[model samples]
Target: MTNRKPPLLILLGPTASGKTKLSVEIAKANRCEIISGDSMQVYRGMDVGTAKIKPEEMEGVPHHLLDIVDPDTPFSAADFQTIGKRLIDEIAARGKLPFIVGGTGLYIEALIYGYEFSEGGADPEFRKEQEAYFLEFGEQALHDRLREIDPASAERLHPRDSRRIIRALEVAHLTGVPLSEQLAKQTKESPYEVILIGLTLERNLLYKRIEERIDTMLANGLVEEVQILLDRGYSPSLVSMQGLGYKEIVPYLQGYSSYDEAVYLLKRNTRRFAKRQLSWFRHMKEIQWVDVTDSSNFSAHLSAINAIIAGKFA
Candidate 1:
């Protein structure tokens, strides 16, 4: 007979979409632990900008993967998949539910689909060549190159997305195959049955929440947080510093822009990021969308989630 166990429940959505609070409430009710799926939140000292859950906010529910790595260290989706799967197993072993929560679609997808990364070696020299090409010719130049070799991949990537552009080029150079084809060839079953719950709102309301969140972060010592990281010798070029709100303030700290200007730019960029996140989640066929515009009521949402979980586990 097949062993009967409960599936993982994933709470995912764009930034500033009320995920942390809702996830905490759900965990409290269901006797579950939350394993964060966010990429940035893994870095130590990245608190305010990442909107990390504070100790008081945890409300006695355990959260995993919030502050595990140094900001300068490399953390990939593959690494997240390995660590998250282990955490889920451990949580299950403790006789509790595992709830995954965050806005990072790639990380969530990696966990839910168990995507495998190729062990194909990357050439530092080749990577440098691509980086130089990106620096000199701009992201469009690299995106155009991807268009020629892998139209499918290029179509998926935004021309302004420098990191993914470089990654696509690196994958193509290392494997002698289009990055899209490499991804297409990889197939792995999910290690856990999962229920993906996607939180969303109307565009205007979402943007409003994002702007308000930025204000709250600023009022809550976001600049001080970045200052502390900088004081600790974390470079602006580090991955953690490159996160949404953190990166925009680097210029201000360096005297390139005023603090107010930096805040404005940060809010604008955050809104754009939220839009991209929504687009990504919209393409995910498995997600059960929850609209929070009218009510913003956690009780209502929790009731819906509890009913879904009960049905799945019953």
Candidate 2:
């Protein structure tokens, strides 16, 4: 038997799992154009906090979908799917593999499986109440409310993503089925010959990398970056501002928390976020998981991944 869908390659994993360096190397060797699957990286001027790839870091391998919107604008999984699908086709047309590389599982899954978003109208009153609740109690408390009704959806969604949390809550309230259940019922059939590669590390080592990454971000002026965004008039209430690094720093800048307190919260929240990422990707049955815990053995890991890709796509 033979399958003939267009080839698509995805390199995804928890944050700080070495996806960035590996993806660029794989792309350069495989003649692939990389599209970012990270939700936060889509916003312009969020470079430091998102750990967005600098041009020099790309090493001439073409990348797409980074810095595409303002911090205040709302970008969602559906937007990623629409644009990602187009890029995949265009890249395939040029005889290059379209490699989606990032830790954002929902965005990648939505694009790969063609998730149809429900058009169920929202109740403004319900939505307003949810917003008010978030404002009063904060994102984690609001996220906990969703967890009670939709644990599956809650597991995949970041606590700071209050917008989606509210939507999931609304969907459950309106339709009586969890948003995760609706997505699970969606046709899982993909439009491409997809090869999903997942990277992982021992939990302790992964946490080390995450902490180091955050330290590097702070040293590289993450605070200044957030300050710039605030100066540009992006409100702290915007969904993008609720992102990991930005949100944690906001209280510090507003004189509510000390710099040390903000840093601690950022590191802890990032670790929790990474754990959620692993949980989400683990639920996707198609991914070929690889352990790249040893930074000293880069070639070994890359070779193994390339072999997997070649075996499937060659």
Candidate 3:
């Protein structure tokens, strides 16, 4: 750890793990401002789908990087790396703790590890050909091409994630460096003194939570929210529209899947996504896990976390 590095408090967990409320409580108590690490939350029109905290819900704790771009605009982990690190520095300079709170493992890792994208050998022509391939077939086809070249990254990415799939193929084609190798090749040094906190619940409990969260979203005008975005001229194929809650609801709104069917699929897929999130965090050894299942209350959990922070920053 760098002796002079600013403190970074991270609160991470799978979807519906109550990370947002817990993070807010901790941040409010500790004079910390949160920098969201979510990919979908950056889009301007996305709210319920991204599980975004409303302004009144923020409880006066400042947040960064939410509602940053339009649905059609492309944002990547590289963007998060740049913007997130800058917020960490800016927050610390203002004499407040910086809290990075989200379930996006790649975004968090990129910020913490200072990941360098070696674009030294990038070939725009080759990248254009890849983009043409994506347009001809689909983003899944693009990811399939990557699977042949870089299986490590392919496993981590969703099939519709064209931006990362293209970048991986570009790296392999130009420099013979797969995206996995580029990240793994770097020395494992975190720039900030991160007080990492990972929240978890029982598996069955978490699945139940996922189902209930979907139910709440539906009741709270999630379908209407998607309609508003479509009404605003965003296409269904836009990357932001393909987010978990947004994409599943599209079929229903387009006169395809019934509302019940869309709701069912959303719940099922979200459970699977939560499982993948836990898998991602499991591999990141730095996060100290706390089973909210075992805790009596959230206050107790925060108290325990404060002890951990004390040891790190004492």
Candidate 4:
């Protein structure tokens, strides 16, 4: 009984670090199924911007929790925690490994720790007011405010992520406690024995990859993807539309900003986002960093992951 480890695996890396393909390959070879931990990827009709994996890319390995909500519907970290925990149980019961994959640090943290969000109850009217304020003074102003109160949370989140920034600010304002401190107070009560595998690369190469991916997304119709979302009556102010790609394109689509300007901002913001993601993961002590600096070491990385699984659960 002591040797029987709880089954849960995590494949984490920044955007454009090649998590999807590596996760699928590992799942295919090891009879594992993937559970997406991405906050934005849960929305429908927002594919290109979120870099969603097509069915073909999944290669027959079952995936869960992607495209499960509309752009307007609010999906919280608690919702993700509930869905992800259930999927892990169901997949393990069915004799497949449950691999939680994505770069969203808070969502992943929710799965690996116990925390109560009850203190941060929403004031819809106040949130709307904050949203309007954000538009007026700009995202940088909002981020600076958050940085003053909850520097840790601000560091982990992108400046343009108004929804989270608002929430963090709200928590601090209402509770008289910083959002980061509240999360820190939680007792770690993770149910599964999580083997967190982090994919890493040289900084220069990683930035290059992020830039190239932004270019690829634009070429692959990311702007058109936002056009469809707007055409469907999803507001530009919706939490989902405020995502990296969608938000950058909204100005260009509305003729307020030039296409080149939007593209430049997208690439710059994406690089910043990736840096925040890396900063977040680096703080977590459990992650086993694997350098995939060269593509040739991919097989070696897989072997390293397999060895960890074997050592823990075999």
Name the candidate that leads on lDDT.
2
Q: Model 4: which residue pairs collide?
A: none
Question: Model-by-model lDDT, in order?
Answer: 0.83, 0.92, 0.86, 0.87
Each model's RMSD to truth, in Å? 2.4, 1.8, 2.3, 2.0
RMSD of 4: 2.0
> Which is better, 1 or 2, measured by lDDT?
2
For every model in order, what is the number of clashing pairs?
0, 0, 0, 0
**Compared with the true structure, what per-residue lDDT tens digits does model 2 show for residues 1-314?**
77689899999999899989899999998999999999999999999999999999999998999988988788998999999999999999999999999988889999999999863668889999999999999989999999999999888777877888999999999998899899888887999999999998999999999999999999999999999999999999898998999999999999999999999999999999998888888779999988998999999999999999886777
Task: Provide TM-scores for the models.
Answer: 0.91, 0.95, 0.92, 0.93
The top-ranked prediction according to TM-score is: 2
lDDT value, residue 128 of candidate 1: 88
Question: Clash number for model 1?
Answer: 0
Better of 1 and 4 by TM-score: 4
**What is the per-residue lDDT of model 4 for residues 1-314, given as tens digits with 9 covering 90 to 100?**
47555678898999888899788888876789999989989999989999999999988999999989999999989999988878888998998889999999888998778567786687788778788889899999999989998999898777877888998888887889998999888766677788888989998989898888888898999988999989999999888998999989999999999999999999889888898899888878889888888867788877776776665655
lDDT tens string, model 1, 63-156?
9998999998888888898998899899988988899999988788877787777736677887788879888998689889889988867866
Clashing pairs in 1: none
TM-score of 3: 0.92
Candidate scoring better on TM-score of 1 and 2: 2
* Per-residue lDDT over 171-276 for candidate 3, one digit per residue giving the tens place of the 0 to 100 score: 8887777878787776568877878889988999999888988889888889999999999999887878878998899999999999899988899889888988
